[model samples]
Structure formats: C-alpha cells, structure tokens
Target: MWNYNFYIYITTNPTKTVLYVGVTNDLSRRIQEHTENKGNKNSFAGKYYCHNLIYYEHFNDINYAIEREKEIKKWSRKKKNLLIESFNPDWRFLNNEINQE
Candidate 1:
C-alpha cells in the first residue's frame, strides 16, 4: 500500500490581508486547485484571493492534519502571521518553492 503525506496549509493573498487554512493529502494538487479557483466560492480561500501558500506542516496521519488545520483556523491573524513568519519571514509565495522542488 502507498502512504500519502497529509498537510495543513495556510495561504494568503499578495497583500497578506486574507488567510485560508485547509488540510489535504495531496498538498500540491490542492494548492493548484485553490490558485485555479476550483473550490466553491463559499469557501474563505475561494472568496478571497488566498492562493499564495505561506506556511504548511506535514503529517503522515490524516487525523492529525485535520486537527492541526482546525487549530490554525481558530488562531487570530496575529498568531497566524507569527507562525508564518517563523518559517517564512518574507512571506514568499510557496508555489515557487513547490515548483522548484
């Protein structure tokens, strides 16, 4: 059996005014879907231009990924920004990082 890694990701707009959190087993594809606006407009990410990935955490367990996503969604903007800064000080779009890898 193949094991897929799961991810809890946070994406923001170019100005970093909007934030969207989600969990997915296929991080790359999910990010692509968000950028393509393939998700429903009712979604926070889809409603806003929150396709620039700013931070992400990987997990082998789906439940853990979901739990982390929930926790992140509940965080205040400041807290979220801090989390992103810890890993991405410049808040660079992670799409390029993904593509490079």
Candidate 2:
C-alpha cells in the first residue's frame, strides 16, 4: 500500500535545542534534505540545524496538513514543548530511530 501525503512535523537538533515546523508530502525526502542541509542558508531548518525527526503526523489531505502546519507555527515554545512531549517525552534525537527502521 502507498503511504498517504502528510504534514504536521517537528524536527529538532541532536541537542533538542532548535526546532522547526514544516509541511511536506514526502516526509523521507524532506528529512533527508534537511539533514543534508541541501537548501538555502536563510531557511530556518537549515540555519538552526534542526534536522532530527522528533515528531510527525500523517495526513491524506494537503489542506489539513497545511492548516496544521500553520497552527503549530503560531504556537508558543511552551505549547510546542507540550506537543513534542506527548510523543517524545525524553526529547530524544529521532534521526537514529528512523535510520534503524
């Protein structure tokens, strides 16, 4: 079965200090690009070294994904922490997890 398009991602550094929110249909490719830093230096994810995949949610509809991305973008740091904590309580670096899978 094909995976559905999705958004609602939270990426961070190995230190878990920098965080980035984005929407992308191709999760694996997007994460790879971020980790490789293959984009403009001015970009938040590139500049902040937020390539670790800490959290993500899949959505079949692009509109819903976009809406959720915007909603997360507008949130405060505290709110974002809470959201991440829901899935990753220890704030672990998820890059290795993905790679091992």
Candidate 3:
C-alpha cells in the first residue's frame, strides 16, 4: 500500500499578528501558495499576509487532519497562541525547516 501524509498547520503574518489554520497533503507547496496570495483581499490569509508557518501536526488520514484543522480554527486566539507556544516556544517561523527529505 502507498503511504500518504497530511498536515494540520498554523501560519502567521510576519509581525505575528494573525494566525491561519489549514490542512494539506502538500505543505510546502501550500505555504508557497499562501505567500503568493499575500495582499489579495479576497482571502483571509491573503488579506492578512499569513504565510509564515509556526506550528503543525501530522496525521495519516485526511479526515482527522481536517477535523483537527476545524478544531484549531475554532480556538480563541489566546488559546491558539498557548497551543503554538507549547509546540514552538519561541513561535519561530518554520517555513524552511521541515519536509526537506
């Protein structure tokens, strides 16, 4: 059987002012798309320039990934920030550090 990977990820603006929660199988490409979409007001991520990845969770199933994404999306910013801090204490931008293999 073929193996697949899915991710529930959180991204923020350069100033760390906003968070965008999403799920994707192709994380690097999706982040690139968000970066490309920056400043376009039609989309929330674009309007807020939320392309800097800060946190992520891996899942083997798309349904679970989507569920987790929805759960995170529902979180208050304060709760989300605490979650991110638990995973990423400094809230460092993690765009280039993962999925390189």
Candidate 4:
C-alpha cells in the first residue's frame, strides 16, 4: 500500500564508519526520531550517532521487512557495504530525500 509501506533501512554516522540496520513503516518519521535520539546512550543508533540514511528497501509486508532487516543485521560490514553500494553507489545521505516530493 502506498499509504503505509514497510521498509528495511540502513543508516550510518556522519563519518560513515558505523552502520545501523532497522525496519520501520514510517521512514520519514523514523529518520527524524533517529536524528532527535542521536547520542542517547540507551539506544544503539543513538549511542553510535548513526542517523544518516544511506540505504533502504521497501516492502509490502512488515514481517518480510523485519526478516530482511534481521538478515542484514547479521551480515558482515564488508557484505553490508557491498549491499549499500549496489543500491547507492556513492553511499549518499538519503535523509533529506525520504519525504521529498
């Protein structure tokens, strides 16, 4: 459904050194939350400041999205980097584009 899509997304720190894998239905809001939560020790993404959107895959089902997210999280950095490069060759920051028309 266009109104509510599930997604498995990847976010990295400004330096692009740390990566965080997550699943969400509202991508724009989630990115905003991550940005607001940056540097909060209680959260992994926050603790590592991994709030810059780098890659994302859309899915119609939440279960499928979560499964993909879990699978990606178990992958090695090298593999994850390869995946991101496949979708985003330059690993560009995608945060600003999430809610854009």
Candidate 5:
C-alpha cells in the first residue's frame, strides 16, 4: 500500500484582508512559492499578498484535496471567514509553524 500527502490550504494577507484557497502536494514548497510570488500582480494570490497560511487540512488523496479547494473557493467571503476562524480563531500565520514541525 502507498500513501501520499496532499493539502488544501487557506492563506491570507498580512492584514488578513484577502483569502487564497489552494491545493498542493508539498505544503512547505507551495508556501515558499507563494511568498516568492508576492507582489506579482498577474497572480491572484500574489497580487493580494495572500501568503500567510491561516488554515490547512491534509488528505491522502489528491482528488479529495482538489475537491475541497474548489468547494472552499466557491463559498462567500463571510463563509470562508467562519471556516478559517473555526480552525484558526486568531488567524495566525502558520508558514513558520509548518516548517518548524
């Protein structure tokens, strides 16, 4: 049997004013890319500076992670806020934490 890691994550700006939902197999690398892509006006995540990880969920199946990302992307901002708050009430940036663990 084989197992793989996939992540559906939510990241926000430093001000916590914007949200970006995405799925990736390498969470740390993905976050790094996001950080590097910051200030890239062509990218939604980059343009908004939504690189502060606030919440994430892991999955063994990539399909499930993609599905969850799409579902979250369709929700209203208010709904998304509630979802993030439920998992990360303080909306703390988790980029450093992920790497430390």
Candidate 6:
C-alpha cells in the first residue's frame, strides 16, 4: 500500500512579528511557493513575508493535518511560541533543515 504524507506548518516573517499556519502535502514546494508569493498583497503569507519556516508537524492523513493547522491557527501567540520553542528554542528558520531530509 502507498502511504501519504501531509503537514501542518507555521511560518513567520523575518522579524518574527507575523505568523501563518497552513497544511500541505509537499512542505518544501509549498514553502517555495510562499517565498515566491512574498510581496503579493492578496496573500496573507506574501503580504506579511511569512515564508520563513519556523515550525511543522507531519501527519499521515490530510484531515489530521488540516485539523492541526486549524488548532494552531486558533492558539494564542504565547502558546504558539511555546510550541515552537519546544523543538526550536531559538526560532530558527527550518527551511534548510526540512529540505535536507
């Protein structure tokens, strides 16, 4: 049987003042699209330059990934920061890390 991979991810601006939560099957490609979308006023990620990957969670099911994304979206900034700090205390951009794997 074939396995499917999905992801719930968070991205932030360079100054880390803005956050965007989303779900995707292709994290790298999606991040790339976000990068390309930067400066486009119509997109929240683009408008805020929220292409710097900061946090992510993988799921085998798309529904689970979407659900988790929604949950994160509803979280307070402090809660989101705690979640990010749990695995990434420094809030380092994780694009390179995910691409290398």
lDDT of 4 by residue, 21-69 (tens): 9999899999999999999999999999999999999988888898999
CA error at residue 71 for candidate 6, angstroms:
1.0
lDDT value, residue 39 of candidate 6: 92
Global lDDT for candidate 2?
0.83
Report lDDT per candidate. Answer: 0.86, 0.83, 0.92, 0.94, 0.94, 0.93
Q: After superposition, how far is residue 52 of candidate 2 from its true place, in Å?
A: 0.6
Q: What CA root-mean-square deviation does each model show from the true structure? A: 2.1, 2.5, 1.2, 1.6, 0.8, 0.8
10 residues in a row with least lDDT, candidate 6: 61-70
Candidate with the larger TM-score of 1 and 4: 4
Better of 4 and 5 by TM-score: 5
TM-score of each: 0.89, 0.85, 0.93, 0.94, 0.96, 0.96
In Å, residue 8's CA in model 6 sits off its true spot by 0.4
Off by over 4 Å in 4: 1-3
Worst 10 residues of 2 by lDDT: 92-101
Which of the two candidates, 1 or 5, achieves a greater lDDT against the reference?
Answer: 5
Segments of candidate 3 deviating more than 4 angstroms: none
Task: Report the Cα lDDT for residue 8, model 2.
Answer: 77
Q: In candidate 6, which residue pairs clash?
A: none
